[model samples]
Target: MSQKTDGDIKVPSKVVVAGFISTFIEWYDFLVYGTVAALVFSQLFFPKLDAFAGTLAALSTFTVGFIARPLGGIVFGHFGDKIGRKKTLIVTLLMMAVATTGIGLLPTYDQIGIWAPIMLVVFRFFQGVSVGGEWGGVALLLMEKAAPSKRGFIGSWAQIGGYLGPLVGAGVLAVVTTFTTPQEFLAWGWRIPFLISILLFILGLWVRLVMGESHVFEKSKKAPVPIASLFRYDTKNVLGIMAVHGAQSLTLYIVIVFFAGFLKTGASFTAAQSTLSVVAYLIGATAASMFGGWLSDYTGRFKVVGAGLVLSILIAFPLFAAAATGNIYLVMLVTFTAGVACGLIYGPEPAYFGELFPTQYRYTGVSVGVQFGTLAAGSTAPIVGTFLLQWAGGGTWAVAAYLIGWQIIGLLGLMALGETRGKALEERPGA
Candidate 1:
């Protein structure tokens, strides 16, 4: 292959496909758990608790994966920055496949007594670790390979996995639940989604194995200790990334994780209807991610992300109100719009974050920073929303207020970072 400078290098189509497929598999493994937790985990693993407490417990296990992410980020980021992005990404994919498929094979409370939930949390933690490492590698792999002007658009393909994973997860669950009786669904149907991870893992592994390492990483000065250098040199940028990403993660779990349960109980919707609503949100997110990434290529990352945060904040109260109305059409419509807002924030994010740090420690900086933000926001969103609903006497106003508050923080985060729309990957920020 002919070599070009980093500023103008054209990424191979296979590289993009590898990044997209690997990312999709990583997220699908992680997120399929959330969908199952919402629908069946409480009943299967935490059977002793009452409905509310059981749901809370199940969601808590979901958070376990997030808690493990930073550690995953720290460990994998170090190696990815030091060795290469390609190898670490392959490890993460295999880790997620094992954890997810393990969950599928696990016996529930009825079959194994107390060991069920204990083993469940163990598997979920591994899933968390896998995902924690997965995003940064793929994001950098795409961002560092693309020409400067096309970075945003190419990077968004990684973000598409974020939305599409959950979309396909919920869609698969919807299909399974539709075909199976309620009793059968609660018994075995949920496991199908988790088991399917094995197939996805094979596809992801093949593509990623064939793809080459990032040329930027190949040429950049390697950090002696990437994480330490990241803290010493780019702490502020890390915090800014956290803030910029917080609101989108918060809103995502609320819709994808919390809303399914809320609709089932609070709005009196069937499980199928609730699952379908998540599919709607994903559809909008998948489309808007492409648009936002393309727009950021022209308008700059701050403009595109800031507009998204503002729109999401404005829609917060309306979204909850529509959910309360018990009208599926209105709920789906508002949810789709909310997805659009969040997508815009997400689409430009990989390139923006990748641009913030020097290539020497870019992997560590992006992985740790984004994982911390996600752990703080996305990890707690469903559990926090559950408590807010109970505290508000089942009213959704408090939840809306909660969402708006985070969006404002995200706007502030956008203000804190410099625009990096067309910045060259090889150029250090200060030097």
Candidate 2:
């Protein structure tokens, strides 16, 4: 490893690849549940309710994972700050793998009655905690190792994994659905994706185990209580990160989780079509994230992210209207555009948030800010969107309005914070 006197460092390509793979595995474990929840959980786990209520119930359980995330952030962030990013990331990956595999093994409502859903929520909570800690650690592991000029681009490899996870998850589900009869799919196919986690876990563990800790973290003075120090010294940045992330979460999850169901129930699309739309969104998101990250290196994080939020707001109504058209290609086009817009916000996020706090508490600060933001918006987006759809007699206008509101809040949050495109990680703002 090479470090300049100005605190910039050169990270090896192998380390970046390892970080990306581990991040992909962790996110795949967490996001596979969302795909299942959208598709079959209502039928399998909440069989007793009417269709509308059942969908709501299934999505509520999905929200449980998000609800547990902040706790994961606080706990894992504590250890990550005190111990090291590499160790904490390994622990989180193990937890996620176990929890995800556990979900695969659980019996449905037909077999276990109420115990099935209860156990599902329990496993989901652990998965949430695992991922809550996973993002900040992997992000720091990459961002902290990269040269200051390349932090945004390198940090985006982690985000790319995040975007790719859903694509791969949805792809797996689409494949299983294609091979199995509807009866078989409902009976056994859904578990295949979850069960595959064990294998991915092995790969991620091997990669992460060989990777080194963040040099930037190793050089920093440790805070006795990183969370407390974070709140006391950088509360404004914390809140700003939350707002920025909250907007992106609300926008993205609405499309990822809510839109799939909307296409099925409202637009009368087939299951495969709904899944395909999500795939398109993920593809566009993944590509745009890479572009956004590279662009942020030159244009500044604030400008790119702010532009994305504004673009999201401008496209809010058009996105839903296109979905309402019931043409799969059109739906894919609009959703892909929405994904690209959201990607701009996500791509710069790791570097942007990591730059806000000193290394002493960066893990805690980033984890708490991002998780809390996700908890507030991403957690309830599907449920809230569903309720709004019902309240509006299945019209998507209300959902569009909801998205616009969050994007505006995100823009305001962007304005509240200073640009951090080229800031050195080791420099504390008020020190």
Candidate 3:
């Protein structure tokens, strides 16, 4: 066997920064859509429905992106496992830009009627496809490049965008809404956030161009058929990862995506107010993720995620009740606190998932797990929550109960997986 050297093991700092920045940029694209859906999309795209129904309709479109994610995962993850992470990432990033810019230029239902929303959905599908393919590559880039000793802490950086993306998206929407009249904002201001993605896309593209491939991926053995190998050998690993990851997705989208709109329609808060509340949740989530990373390093990845799942169960009713009270401050507090629990789970899963499969097919396994898991969890949570509210006669209690029931499934998932903490990636096969 060939011996490893310093050059083989060391990954550059610029690549790491680019990973963080580009991850932020790509995710920012998705969050902007999320922000707009919760704010102005209902009025512009589906003005005929009642306020609640229109918001529900707009949120359903948001799910379209998540639904496309698994396909993105399959396509992108395949190439990422075949080629290298960096090249495949460039493709996904560019795809994200084109899709986001199209959304910015799309005509509204007022202007084009049915054609308008159909176009928007098409662009949104592109966004989902690109982002779906994107996360696995981005996460692997970071996790594979980082020092093995600091896998939990350093790999956690892979999700910095997880915090900043929503924060920036909501902040921008809040700014545009606060400054412009509702009429002016609806007509033009809403497009500003989407358009700003062009600049972000360009910047992220440059950083990616400057960076290189993951050191571990470059040195590892290639699977003859990555995705097939993943299913053949790692079926149990894939299912376990999906359940654990899906729990976090359900928690985040239910709160950030669904609850944001619910604040506007159910809690009677204005769009700006609802957006601001989401900002609070993102801030809490981001902070919690940072802390969770540090905590996971000391404890195990599964332990940290388990605690977060437990927290989700405990806080479901209170978090929903807090949002229902129509107090923005209380809503912010509960959202932020709940987000901390989400961070705990979100922070470690990437590193944990990366460690589960062999390097020969790590990208495909994690991407498939993360993306396919979304259908059951994040993609459907908003739609499910909205209906749950309607089923309970417009009360949050049913939604809260549904959330508790959901977490129970994730808890069971956590138990199925074994610990991977401190598992070093072996560069040489059959060592």
Candidate 4:
């Protein structure tokens, strides 16, 4: 169902828009929670605890969402394989919307006793599950429809949503907090951002409704087997994909999502300043991500990913040190650099990882790869970074050293693998 636009490139606008909008909604729900966890959730949800302990509690609740990602992947992957990608994704979208909007309505410590944080944990875990289910289908839907040469560029659209998700969340939160008195903001104004997710989800749903099922997945439906066969037969490929995904997750959640909080709490920036800087960083990252995907088409995924890892190692300490010095310009420069590095890794990942498994096993393979990272590196980095900051007397060195170490791990993982550039989807059996 390709439509001819002015460029006359045969393209499915509805599918592309659906894929983009759906991912935007999913990540919007996920990122807002992360932004709040880093800044306000610790104060709101864990109000009774001391600052450090409260931060830890908030992070732990956030990680609970990560902990559920694998299960979501498994469940959604199973149905995506058996029933279809479109319907399975629709269900995840609904779940995410409900859980996210519910988080806005929950009572605090004064009204609900222990149920406040308890309900937050439950809603967050559901959000995690929904996101885990969401990414695999969104990637599959887009990559399946795109031309081989253009798949990298197309797939990177999802990464754009990832960056934009935080921007929207931080931007809205920043605007709301700016106008409100601190007392009013801390009381109920913060809930406005979470409540607004209902509108985002509804808009995304409207877009997704107009789209059709992916031709690739539809073609594969002729003789589909259970998704379980993927793990049972291709365990080695699964493990390899997991490693790469771990690298993406750790770099993303640890550095990008939590960096604002780190700057605000540890580096002594005001919340407004931190949010604005993060929005700027994300904007740069979004632009770099699209460019990185285009570069991968020419340069290859392995090289681009490997280069990003090396850059991470080299600049980790320098970037943090610059930010620690309280130079506003220096902070923006380093943060923007970090965002670009994340873009380099994230941009190429959808196609790279999708190519690691066969069409029949693609959903399970990508989901497992991603969620494994979420469970291991992605969820733990923020908490670990916080502890490292404390241990290092709030110095930037420890946080930088920790991030660099993980990047080195990802570099080694990428270097050990063979390049998969220029291989046709059908020619590459695993893919």
Candidate 5:
């Protein structure tokens, strides 16, 4: 590994910036589907299904991608541990872009019958695979070049990709809907935003190809490459990491992906109103993510994360009640709170989990933890929320109870994990 010369550590290079750009594109492409599903998918693809059932079906497609994420992580993480981060990342980026573009061109249910939904599922699976491999590499690359004390801050940028990705996705949907009527928006305009994803893919691919490998992973030559061995020997860290991931994934998906859906159905908001409210929520999230990263730098990671989890637990019922009653001002207030909570929880997970393993197994460890959370938390939230809503006769209390349970579980997970906020990368395993 090359040592940084004087002043070289102060500024990130073009390649590092490119990593952020590439991650932003990857996340944006992945998140755009949820945005579309929330506003247009039910009408377009599941037109014949009942409203709640159609939503469940749409969310089911979204969860399918997440279900495929672990496989992607294992494949990419293995090669990344054995070969290198830069090359592996290039492949994931291309896969994600192509899959996203393909969805743009796919025929709708009106045109193709059952095959339309099947093909959509297939493309979504491709996206999941690509994203699974992408994040571990991107996070390591950025953090490797960061100054020792600034790892949390720099690592948080990878997370910023998650927040900002949705912002772009939702913002595009919001802007398109703001001017277009529902008939026009559903018939054609939704596809327009999806088609634009191709440009983002091309741009991301070019940037990722130019980025360099992480110095830390390169230097840890003796570190184990077998993911199973990492798990077998480091089971405790794996479990701890998975719990942290579960909390973050559940909270984020509920607030971001499901908010638009929940509002349209539960609160009976117009498409434009829901879009606008979600856009505002995302704006809060983007700011909160940056602030959370800064907070992790000054305070400990666990402290910030714990605060986020506890706050969610306390406010979940109130927030849902406000949104459920269809009070526009209260809805906005609660939505903003949920977004801020998501930002706070999400901002630290990448860095916090990344800090848990030896550099050689770092990619595998983080990816597995995150992937498990996708399975445990991400895949289940929408389905569970929908089911609860149905059983309770669309009562907002049902949704609130369901969400608060996850938050409490997350808080407990945080309490059990070791705090490694400022520990050196190399010193983390024994910290």
Candidate 6:
């Protein structure tokens, strides 16, 4: 699949697989923290607080990682634009591996007291920083490396990988917890998922090593200041990227990650039930994204995203109503439905984001735009959902209302943007 030109710059079809691996590792490390935070971090690290307070505190830590994403995008994105995608990607992987591993080694509250939570926050912040750099780099590498005609399908590999991470993390917890008691899981069993990230680290490094640098980046001129060009030449594109990406960013965390907390607190679901539902939902999300991305090649990207936003709007109340039913099967069904909606929204994003900027500033533009959206939408979503839940005394409408707002913002952003599906990467428009 690598398309090599006259000389030696051949882009392998394997770039799609490489893209999947990159996001798989990145999101796997990221989501496990949220999964555990919802299920057990409250007990392990913040046992002093009562159930509601402890859950809130734990969910807050999950948001901390998201807060650091934009900064990661800023720093790593600068270097990625100045230098190249491969080196910047290598650094992000290292940061994620180190932080994820260190998290496994941290002593719990009983052993380390306040230092446990402080250290967890510090490591989680770095994890955010690492992933902040990760998405744009991977998306750029894949979309730029791919042929224009196939960018949507190829780029969706990132979305597939994104789902794979949480899928794997949730699966691990579901299995591990099956064997251990609640007492044992809180004490030691939770560390297995974090520790297992070392294998992902090794596997990711190998895949990255086999991949070549992007031919698009290699051929493009280096901007004197890439981000400056992004702001000056492509301001609207940046905003459009944020809005187009906003809803899915928030909904993934809120509807998927936050739902686990909701199940545990309000619905009395078991940890296994919550995590297993994630496993099934992720499988559906992966398939839906691949189909969505492929379909976007035929329909315009905006149409696919617009349809998805509409679906989210229609199902907003019903999805939560299912959750409130306290029937685990019904909750899982609605989660899968939302996963389908997310896949459609997420499928076209990597290609869509890349199309928004010229090669000179693509890394910075995409990174800044996507990371800011994550900060605004992704990181804060769970917090907002939990707060709404608390305020409404466990009402689901407020959460549904929050999702509608994201969809509307994203739709507005899309309306102002032009479609760029088959456009050549070098054909930087308007800017």
Clashing residue pairs in all predictions, respectively, total: 0, 0, 0, 2, 0, 7
- Candidate no. 4 TM-score: 0.88
Number of residue pairs clashing in candidate 5, backbone atoms closer than 3 angstroms, sequence gap of 3 or more or interchain = 0
Q: Candidate 3: lDDT of 124?
A: 88
The TM-score between candidate 1 and the true structure equals 0.91
What tens-digit string does per-residue lDDT give for candidate 5 at 139-198? 777666676556667767777766577668767866888889989988888787778877
Q: Clashes in model 1: which pairs?
A: none
Candidate 3: RMSD over Cα atoms? 3.2
Better of 1 and 5 by TM-score: 1
**What TM value does model 6 have?**
0.90
Lowest-sum lDDT 10-residue window in model 1: 1-10
Name the candidate, 3 or 4, with the larger lDDT value.
3
Candidate 4 backbone collisions, by pair: 357-430, 358-430
| Over 4 Å off, model 4 | 1-9, 35-56, 109-114, 221-227, 257-259, 264-272, 392-395, 427-431
lDDT of 6 at 274: 79
Q: Please, what are the lDDT tens digits per residue for candidate 2 over residues 157-176?
A: 98898878766776687688
- The ten-residue window of minimal lDDT in model 4 covers 1-10
Candidate 6 residue-wise lDDT, 329-410, digit = tens = 8878877877888889898888888877788888999999989987778777876898997898878888889889898998
Judging by TM-score, tell me the better candidate of 5 and 6.
Answer: 6
Clashing pairs in 6: 1-12, 1-13, 2-11, 2-12, 2-13, 3-11, 4-10
TM-score, each model?
A: 0.91, 0.91, 0.89, 0.88, 0.87, 0.90
The CA-based lDDT of model 1 is what?
A: 0.85
Candidate 3 per-residue C-alpha lDDT over 94-150 given as tens digits, one digit per residue, 9 for 90 to 100: 888888898899899999998877888888898888888888888778777766555
Q: Rank the candidates by TM-score, best first.
A: 1, 2, 6, 3, 4, 5
**Model 6, global lDDT:** 0.82
- What Cα-based lDDT does every candidate model obtain? 0.85, 0.84, 0.81, 0.74, 0.73, 0.82
Candidate 1: lDDT of 228?
86
